[model samples]
Every structure is written in C-alpha cells, then in structure tokens.
Target: MRKSAALALAACVAVPAFARTDVGVSIGINEPGAYGRIDIGNFQPEVVYAQPVIIERSRYYENRTPVYLYVPVEQQQHWRRYCHVYRACGEPVYFVQEQWVEQRWREEHPGWRRHHRGWDRWDHDRGEHRGYGY
Candidate 1:
C-alpha cells in the first residue's frame, strides 16, 4: 500500500512536468502589448508625456534624436527600473499613447487574424481551429 501511494504521488507530479506547454508570442510594433521603439512614419503619434523620459543620461546619445516607443503604462511610470528591457537606458524615450498604438495597428492590419502555425498546429490537428479566412 505504501509503495502504491508513493507511486501515485510521483505520477501526479511527473504528469504535470511532462504536460507543461510553453507558448511564445512575439508582439511586433503597433501590436497590442508591444513594448519597444515604434516607427513614427508620417503619422503624428499622441504621446503619453510631453517631455521625453531619459533614465540614463549619456554623452553618446546627446546628438541622437529621441525615439518614440510604445511601452506599458507601468513601465513608462517606472522607466528607471524597466528601461533596460527595451535597451534604451542611455537614450531618450517618448512613450506613445496606448489608444493611438491600437488604432494604428487596427488600421494597418484591418483583416489580421491570429495564425496558429508550427507548434501551434496542434490546434488545427485537434479541429479546434476556426478557419482564419485562410
């Protein structure tokens, strides 16, 4: 009975370890939840703050122009702590308004649909995929 209980507990733990699935989604510029430098292009972006936020001041970036970014609200507020994530610690950053980013993404990818390819093809095999209009 003790061996069976121990085996059952081991099986329970091992099952979850093997069943773990990691899904990596790369969010590009203008996409929802994307945090990085954004291409300003010809469109004027509404900024979150009027003044650019500079976490780390460096002489190297003095001549370089301030780049616009679309970062999370929390990251924008605590830029000093999160600037390294975007590799803009030594440069000036202007956080664009989230609403504007979403609007631009929708405009550009009017018919965008999430594509389940590669490892995500399991959904297609399981018949869980709703046709994405090809």
Candidate 2:
C-alpha cells in the first residue's frame, strides 16, 4: 500500500498539465470547504467511493428492477479474492471505486466485446471504434 500510494502520488505529480486547446467545457470542483479544480469536457464525470458490497453468490439484481449487473466469476482478480478473504476475517477494506469497470474495459479494448465472437467486430477500419462514434 505504501509503495502503491507513493507511486500514484509520483505519477500524478509527474503528469503534464497541457493547457486545454480544444473548445471544451470546464467544471469547477465541489467540496464542503475545499474547491475542486475545473474539469474540461462535454459532460461532467466523477466517481465516488461507495461501500464494498458482499454477496453470498455475488449475483444480486437491482432492488428496483431489470437493470441486472454482476461481478463476473472471471474477474475475481488475485487481489480481489485476497481482499474478500481479508474482509471475511473482519478486516476493513478500503478499495478503489469499482463503478463503470465494465465501461472502462470496453473503452480500453473496444475491439472485443464481452463473450461475443464472429457476428460482430469492433471495426477500427476508421482508426477508431464506430461504437465510440469517432
């Protein structure tokens, strides 16, 4: 954790803050006492650290309706399993926010969709995924 925190801090501090050159929107950071810096983009995007959810089967439907989501059995990364066991043993786990994990993976590897083959392809023939509307 110490190493990871240090590395993350170093990476953030090392980032090149290129002045925004494109015509973009900017959003100010919001906090109780501290102000957040401007975020430039078409839409405002942010993430909050929600509590870790545990599941006996890890298969829970939304309390409201058909918006079904799951933690794929294949996604139990080594660290995740370790954390699950650690928490089971009553240790507090402060994990990174896991929302939009599916979206993030899709964004990074748009060429491949989850569990699909042949009938569809992420056509990068235009040098970008048409799904991304480039």
lDDT to native, each model: 0.76, 0.38
- Candidate 2, residue 69: the lDDT equals 19
Error of 2 at 75 (Å): 13
| lDDT per residue as tens, model 1, 18-87 | 8635434223464666568886654557898888788768777769788788888888888999988888
Judged by TM-score, which candidate is best? 1
**Model 1: what TM-score?**
0.57
Give Cα distance to truth, residue 64, candidate 2, Å: 34
**Count of clashing residue pairs in every prediction:** 0, 1
Q: For model 2, how does the per-residue alpha-carbon lDDT over 1-134 read when each residue is reduced to its tens digit? A: 99999999988876755445455654332322222122334542323324333333233323422111122333323434543533331322223223434454456566755565755456635464567665
What is the number of residue pairs that collide in model 1?
Answer: 0
